[model samples]
Target chain A: MNQKTNISQIAVVGTGVIGAGWIARCLAHGIQVIATDPAPDAEANLRKSLQQAWPSLEKTGISPGTSPEDLIFETDMAKAVEKADLIQENVPEVLELKHQVLGAISQACRKDAIIASSTSGITPSVLQQGCHCPERLLVAHPFNPVYLLPLVELVAGEKTEPAVLTRAESFYKEIGMKPLIVRREVEGHVADRLMEALWREALHIVNEDIATTEEIDAAIIYGAGLRWAQMGPFLTFHMAGGEAGMRHMLKQFGPALKLPWTKLEAPELTEDLKEKVINGCETHAGNKSVTALAAKRDEFLVEVLQLAEKYWPEPQSIMKK
Target chain B: MNQKTNISQIAVVGTGVIGAGWIARCLAHGIQVIATDPAPDAEANLRKSLQQAWPSLEKTGISPGTSPEDLIFETDMAKAVEKADLIQENVPEVLELKHQVLGAISQACRKDAIIASSTSGITPSVLQQGCHCPERLLVAHPFNPVYLLPLVELVAGEKTEPAVLTRAESFYKEIGMKPLIVRREVEGHVADRLMEALWREALHIVNEDIATTEEIDAAIIYGAGLRWAQMGPFLTFHMAGGEAGMRHMLKQFGPALKLPWTKLEAPELTEDLKEKVINGCETHAGNKSVTALAAKRDEFLVEVLQLAEKYWPEPQSIMKK
Candidate 1:
């Protein structure tokens, strides 16, 4: 499972925050990188960003021979991407701009080179529309601070080769990532949809003046946020379901789904939806009972609580700030 | 102000998961507890929960003089509330049942004793409608495994005295909790509203067959969840905005708010809302620059990623079981 990525050299197309992040991560993994950006000061900015991120990357253990100074900054996109095995495009999230940059990169890069987009919203199918060889294009969206967070959602375009996805998965894993292969193409993908939902609700909370942004932040940092660090909503609720797991939880809180708890209208809690949710959780829990899973959660929470106390900024005294 | 709560002796009504949690937390804080529930096996179940939680509580440090053995169980609600300084109710989340139980406890308890309901959906205003001494009742909702999570959203009713909310705040703070004083009463309070929004969207994802429960959980455990433990969404985005902070972020990604990203509809990103969010984050960031904050965030992520790797269950491979 820990097989090395055959991809030894890559080109990072764009030198913004996300592009710099990819450079830092790949450099830390000892992969050679050529980064290209059209902005006048992109090279200096990316260099500075790498300098800032290097210490942290080192703490996470940098690869043997890679250094920030080893990066190549090319003003010409074609020249930069020509020889690399993969080209990670992190340009701004506009469709026209992405199509334009991607079109140029696809023409220049090797035919077998993987063209991965860091787009948070656009689908890979949409992104691969006008590419030279669309079969090699895929969406490999990583979270912010890409040097650290391990998730990289891998979504294949309609024209993408299955082998391309398989290669991308191994390459991403080789660079210390957990690639979640999205089964369907949708706006915001999986993680961002969940995040955007919470973000929208949070914005509404702020709009209505129910709580300040600080208080809302405190609301998360102190409670659900701590647990989220270890488990997603499904597994967390599975443990909360007690001995019966999701079966009991859906029964108990299922009705509340209809309540005007959030502005987001919930799906009908039909028997089919209920079984899918329950079965999903039961399967995710595996050999562990709810109590056993809960014990592990509690142990994780105890340590994370301490870590949070140390890192979470001193919140403005409730509403008193 | 870490003032010791004036609440020394407390009553826990309805010895279910939440009530037992209250008992465990109280005992750990050295408070005297008398818990009451009419169910046949309530006491036995509560005792078992306490035993399971005690080891974790001990790791968080227990008050010297108090232990789980000091708890008293009474089947009669009147006897439970009569002598205690404060009574924490954790009954099932049914309106009529809450009104009936609260009506009874408000009448039987000491006139000066504070009554707090752990209702996740119903507001305190509705819960106090028919209760005797309604001014003493407020909503003090705690998350699951309440013994560990530090957040408690405190909402006061229309008839409740401001002084009672003041006391409740100090009391929850005294118990090693972060009490978020919700300014406006609404369904699900603050945190749960955010959580419910995410949960609903997650269900939609599963219903649409976008991803499995395991992949969804992996989406979070590896990425946003790690950051969430230390910084909530506002500050997280704040740092993502780079040098200009949230100000720059809104300019960059605010248009996406209008896109159909999540099932939930986002509020119009009006200029007023923009300033409020930007101001909120800027105030929260205080003297730190975005780089400084990102550095802190990176350091925390490095450690938390290690913690998560150790604790997060082995996720099933991407799309394959």
Candidate 2:
């Protein structure tokens, strides 16, 4: 499906970093954007975020032009969704807020318009529960610095239409994203849940003084992490077996299966733990502002994307049996 | 310390892929190398690997112009280690063979010369148990394509000398590696254990027909694996928390902590499993020979190393408390 007939006008609700990012990305790819957020300064904030996003996008040779002045920033949600082919909701994580936004967008947008939520952990079913037309609602979770990172987890809720998912996938591909359809609906989808497990354990290690945040980081980036970037855990281990392969590796090291893992039973969010975490992050983060750190992250993400694109060009077509 | 005063010669006692890799890295940084292997054509093989390694090294500007002519390959272990400052043993992973080679190298090399094993999983203490001078022997495990990847796990044996560890660390730094002194000796040191866990699980998935090898690889590389290249498990999670940090992440999803991981207990190396593994690798590997695959791996590794050097330059001095 080509972009002209399939995806043209896109509505981005809630002009936060993610919302503004969607607008920037869509506009960069020549898709017209209509954005909405409740706050009085939301339009101004989105304008600023878009301005900052433009140069980086330009560096990748995909400019959204001199100014996003052609983009519409509507205060009314209905007006924002009126002429949109796709609605990307970036509202807050609260169930009540999501229900309200999705319902409003569904009522105003075209019957076939794909409505995708940018929720990281909330399941599609829960978010679609309050939608007037739940069939169009699905989770399309993108990583931070959305314009750069290629992954977008497309999850279908119980009520999501199959056609909605196919159209959403096509839209993502057009905008330069690698979308993986999660077969089942689980909390946190696929990527976030696995990440949550490692993260939870990492926190426990930090709390227990087994390792500092920096040390824990060093353990991955400088060690197994370098290999992980190029190949996943399994292929890496497959090679680790020398010529013997995975079975050999497993058989040799199988006895250590019962070693205690650091996967902590989720701790109660005590006030002390909160302060400890904040302080820990602040110490390593130094005086750099959040915007600055984000910009730095985006810069690195761009480099990594360029490298991957150069090495692994996508297969032209999938051969079906 | 500058290179002049701390000038050292190294004996690379194996002339295989790893041994030649060590030679390339050491000599590129201006250290003299004495390589040895019992294979009649070991010198020829070493020359071939070096020729393959040069272009990438040159691109990184780390190749010290010394030719293969500068390297001395001998069949005699005594001649190889006679006056060496450091002896890196990359021999086959047989205990009896290691014992024999290490004993000879220990007897011939200078008393102060640190003898380091390139064993990925074998603990140094066990390897050094039969050595006459066990105090000088330790494990200096480098990842595959050692010349490119910066990480080198330096694990000390029970009888390993503290001074020897210090000297090895300094030497590793001089040759441009991020040497981490693993505090406790564990099988596979640190990285291998984590790799083994993931690998064992992957084999189980493939063995059970849950996922194909390529699918599992795509799951990681397209998802969590990409983030890992730049940040570790903890830092990446810390960022995942948005403004709430790790505590919020843990508190939200800690209840699922007890869910059984798919990480299989190492499988039995049955004849069938071995055959399956061999055939699986062969089919997936396609037409490339082992040497060809190794060469491809080396090329990618060199590119990654150059990129890493450009982005994350090793700090001259770490802050000390």
Candidate 3:
């Protein structure tokens, strides 16, 4: 087994959006990656994704190399897990599939290797139940376009070992992520649950015709969102009070606390509502092809990340400022 | 009466945060302003505020000049409104005070002059009822530090003239603002109402102990907020669907729409809640003197505005890009 101090190699199982993004980010950070998927064209698709990500990463000075040919692709899951320091599973969200894949990988990998799932909503303990090496399994969920956005929620299962957790955290940092350890496993982790709340309200507003899809969007992008990017809501409110701070604002505005909110529960996935949502999104996005939109998004993401990086530099460089 | 195409002389009543910010923004755009307040040290405070805003405007090449010497300050309301093409009132939120000031300013200013309120919640119609030339009275509500943030909500009362509305829009555009016309009268207009929804939820979360103020903030700033600054929530979701568009997203996640939200109504100004809010805010913003915190906020605001300005240039310059 490779010692803890040696440069780590990561195994990426599944070659979908999240999986491909993981491969791209890890390779860009000079970590060797062993990527595996069952689809006949998985290797080609992964290559295509990396080719698309190159320009934006280059613009932001995060391109790890000239090519991703250094990345190894394998068809066999067991082979992919062999000799890997960490395994990041990004397969379908189905619990059954997760159990089978994780069980196989855990049985095949080095005993000390840390295993993580990129499942957004599911609990780690539930997912790890079938794994023989459950102590090594946890959730290391990352947002879309992982190469650009710098946040990962490191969630530990009940059986996850402390050392494995530490190793996973260190490895995430090595690949340029700001890993936040979620103390308890909750549905949707931290960010997604908060997002779900706002998203539910947004849907309700659309359904109720209080605002159109576009108008609701306009309210956010042009308003509080600008402040939100730099500071959290609390800090924004704290600032809103001028010198008075959050408490002052809460006290002053507290009287209106019982106002009705549009925080609707998750609407039933009725065919009609789904149709409205999908159509609304299509109309709003206009003529851009999926590839075009993704590329544009990646480019903008690079710019935003670069801007954020200036304010929040690497931990080492933070002290220098 | 000056009927020329330009508005040269303007009056800013009330030298508070919003009022001073309006003065700074107006003067920076080369419109001469006559500022008035009843406080004994109003002139000194205005000067101090202007001095604080100078460095930022200077950096952006839109500096309004070094001193408020160009900004004439007067104790007498009529003297300040005399010969002014426009009057922007930013007094306290009390209705009686607003009525008194609007009545006095209308009696003093040119018949063609537009009277605009910076009130966040009060309707323009309510505020304009006391004025003789109600057609000229409207709301030109702006966020704090009006010079740096681009959004300005313009609401016309029932009696507001179309000509006045047109002129107000043009005036706001000329001063580097993204002026949004509120087609209908609403209590908090558009932006504030949406903000109040989220703010109300935030208060509930803090009061409920689901999350700390800091953690709730972290969830936003680090996650959804970054996307919001560039695009609104709907557009971001549209992009998330990877070309399937908003329709795909709404369809996929249309269920779970009725989750209970912590959307509390505005809390009553109960002494206990009031003290909690006050103490919570002070604790969150410990030790940073109000002036020092304000200065820091101003510095960051300048940077963010500059960055956003690059993406959204004056409409004319956008063609060049």
Candidate topping DockQ: 1
Clashes of each: 0, 0, 33
Off by over 4 Å in 1: A1-4, A315-321, B1-4, B315-321
lDDT of 1 by residue, B88-177 (tens): 999899999999999999989998999999988899989989698889999999999899998899999999999999898888877888
Question: Comparing to the true complex, what docking class would candidate 1 get?
Answer: medium
Model 2 per-residue lDDT tens digits across residues A1-321? 244347888899998757877887788878888999999999998887687666656655474353566688889889989888889999877789899889888889898888999997788999988898899899999875565555688889999999889888878878866677776766666555445445444444444434445544555665556555445554444444434444444454333333333222223334443333334333333454433433343343334434533332113211000
- Name the better of 2 and 3 by DockQ: 3
**Candidate 3 per-residue C-alpha lDDT over A1-321 given as tens digits, one digit per residue, 9 for 90 to 100:** 224435468899998878988987887777789999999999998998787665545544554343677789999899999989888999877789999999999899998888899988788999879788999899999876676565688889899999888888777777766676776676666666666556555544444444455455556654566556645555555444444444455455444343332332222334443333334333323454433433332333334433433432123320111
Candidate order by TM-score, highest to lowest?
1, 3, 2
In candidate 1, what are the lDDT values of residues A22-66, reduced to their tens digit?
A: 999998888889999989999999999999999989988888877
Model 1 Cα shift for residue B277 (angstroms): 0.7
Higher-lDDT candidate of 1 and 2: 1
- The CAPRI category of model 2 is incorrect
The lDDT of each candidate is 0.90, 0.64, 0.66
What is candidate 3's CAPRI-style docking category based on DockQ? Answer: incorrect
Best candidate, TM-score-wise?
A: 1
What TM-score does model 3 achieve against the real structure? 0.74
